[model samples]
Target: MNARLRRIVTSAMALSLAVPLAACGEEQTDAGAGEKTIGLLLPENKAARYENFDYRIISRRIATLCLECELDYRNAKSAVDTQKMQFEGLVKKGVKVIILDPVDAQAAKSWVNSAAKKGVKVIAYDRLAEGDVAAYVSYDNESVGRLQGQGIATALGSQASTANVVMMNGSPTDPNAPSFKKGAHGVLDRKVQKIVSENDIPDWSPAEAKKKMTEVINALGPEGFDAVYSANDGMAGGIAEALKSAGIRNVPLGGQDAELPALQRIIRGTQSFTIYKEVRPEAETAAEIAFRLLEGKSIKSLTSTTADSASKSGIPAKLFSAEIVTRKNLKDTVVQDGVVRVDLLCTKDLATACKSLDLN
Candidate 1:
């Protein structure tokens, strides 16, 4: 790891030591009379990481940062209306500091403005929700797309210059989607023969991606596209299934989010690569920023840079780096970082593959 990444990992480790093991499951609302509340609103649960990793990590980090602060957590399940209602509810409950991952970035402008009117500080988490955001925490999303593009080019090898690529992008409502698309296009347009087909999926739905891939296959035949670029692992899973159903094999496929199943597919030689953005530091950083904001403390030390949204400029932001995970460095990247355990990743069925990679 580089110096900055090492510093982030070190900070996360130190914060993790603050909360005891026994306090992990304690009710967050069981605070004293004068205790404050921090609201956490996530965009969706369809992607397992939001509920499985992000929520748990942020909640735990908050507990570690402020034992007296209560967390009001809610998931929008990918519904804009639901998220709006949830945001309104949080404001009504007088939550002064809210960490919001909006379902629709554009729609969040009014919500953020409303919050600001009530003297509530809103921290944009993961997705850059437009408005008067106090602080934004996420990976360099355009860099993520560039990494995916580079992975595809590398996987294509000698055929990269002549390869036809199909692109399956994420939800349009997500503010980050356009940047990912732009970054990927920046590389792929110059590297590949041509982009044969492209589609922006709704809700980042895997089923929709599969259906679109199937349509592309029907229109262009098996040899039409040499490789596929998916914006995320969830949709990539759908694309993988679509390829399988069509009996298409050995096509270079790439995705982000380093999801477990995607990593397994990489081991099995189905998927080419995944971009692993360490969620721990991102979540922990958000928690720390939110806590500091709640306490009216300066967060100049926490944020590394500034980010501009559609409705806001020079917003305090901490953007982290990501790594592209391929079969060659599986052990070095995710394994060494303890993102996934060898025992769990190397299942009974994958014993030979595990042995071949010396993952055991």
Candidate 2:
């Protein structure tokens, strides 16, 4: 393994030991007859990780931490008003600690402030919500964008310095979106020949990304841009379809969130790369932080860093590192870590590719 991959693996192992998901034979905290509750509010269901990994891992960890602590889970479905209602509902239920991934980070300021007034502590999960947040847990998002930019440059090979690129950014509502865009621009601005077209995709919609890509293709023609930088995997799927429709091939395309489809596309030689941020550590850490808050214990050991939101500064935070996943490291990273099962990734049509990669 390379130095970066080794560091990521080592850090993850250390975190897993610090806050184990399964504490076998360990003494558990009991709430007696009255059960305590922890509120979990996720931003959307569009991203596969929120439901499949974040919710499941966090819930399981919370259960292991305190058997009597019940989780009040709610998904906003990408609606700000809906999330506001959910936040209010959780606070009204007397839930003390709430884990929130805001649909609109800026709009969450008022909601979080209100929750604070009600003696409710909110832990900003994944996306940084603005307010008096008790704690924050997520990956180093700007580095994620830097990885994407580097992936595109690597895919472009000798033409990287003189390559024309199109940038497809994430939602305007998400605070992390600007960081990703800024980080990508930091590299692309100095590395690439020029950025021909750029757009901030609303809701990170795949269809809208497809429409934008089609327009860019029509405006600039097939050979105008040498590469495409998609902020996440879902939009990358649409951009890939647009490229296929335009009969344009061999253009380097990059994305984040190592989704199943993006991995398959990488194997099929369509999408070039995807950033894999291990959500297990992120979610489990958040759960541990929540439990600590409930117990009135200090989270100093867990959160070694601080972050700033619009309304709050010096908020305790724990940010994990991410890795760049390509066809080459597919087996070593996601498959080895059990993030994606071989059976789920290797379909009948992809059997040959899977076998070649020794994925099965």
Candidate 3:
């Protein structure tokens, strides 16, 4: 989520709920008389998903139902202050509903509380927010982490212990990062020896990961490292580049986010696995939730249970499923379904590798 997006979503909720209680009166079906603006707040531009998928999905869904309704979107750029300021701006602009993906869950409490006081409905997106919220939408993050950890084990085969494993973690600022780390460690820390280096990447930046991996390569010498457990594909690509520059081959690495390059790396066997959180399904879920909220309908049918945030309990939540992606499962998971084109995954250098795996 981007910071600007958080404010936009929160503002939409705030502005919509701000409608005079007497006018709304529990449930008013009239679309023209009630809320008008819908805010979509994302945490940062660190991941391509925010710009490439979320904005379009949300805006298109809003347009389908409410032609006159406006969508106010923003990106926080990984700054709590910036996100908070954006929230205030959206509130001032009078957005009716807010779909928030917070940068700092702790720092977002004040905005959530204030929005609630003013009758705004805040729907926590991908990442959960603190305090009162209307609803939440995200994938099973822990499960995704567990899948990544399990994939690492399978990729290592019988020689996993001989391989030195390094961790390139996601941002500490994000709540999901810790969960992912915990889940991964639950698997890797048990059997793996020599935890070479563990780096908590800032803003999930590849450049930062490249710097850290380069340093690790320098410290450990050129070739002894066995694997890099990069939190996402962006950082995994960075780690791969560092390894290539050092001329250290025979490494098995893992990453999440089936980005184009990561998929290519998987095809070439430079990267072992990636967690594919498909964009269309995730976006469609968000779209459905927003429309449901707008119609004053209970989305209870859409959600199964609740996931509590650090400062909030029993927050309504809907979590989608995530799948493990490897070169082996590439055809079934992404390529066959056309989530990622096979031509993109199989480049000239990777052609031999792809064919060996029976990839057409």
The number of the candidate with the highest lDDT is: 1
Tens digits of lDDT, candidate 1, 201-233: 999999999999999999999999999999999
Return whichever of 1 and 3 wins on TM-score. 1
Q: What is the TM-score of each candidate against the true structure?
A: 0.92, 0.91, 0.85
Best by TM-score: 1
Over 1-360, each residue of candidate 2 has an lDDT whose tens digit, in order, gives 465765665555444444333211222334231127888989999989887778877877787899778777888899999999878776766778999999999999998998898777899999999988899999888888888889988999899899999999999999999989988888888889999999999999999999999999999999899999999999999999999999999899999998999999988889999999988779989999999998889999999899998788999999988999998999888777767778988989989988999988
Winner by lDDT between candidate 2 and candidate 1? 1
Estimate the lDDT of model 3.
0.76
Collision count for each candidate, in order: 0, 0, 27
Clashing pairs in 1: none
In Å, residue 51's CA in model 3 sits off its true spot by: 1.5
After aligning candidate 3 to the native by TM-score, how far in Å is the CA of 49 from where it should be? 1.6
- CA lDDT, every model vs. true structure: 0.88, 0.87, 0.76
TM-score of 3: 0.85
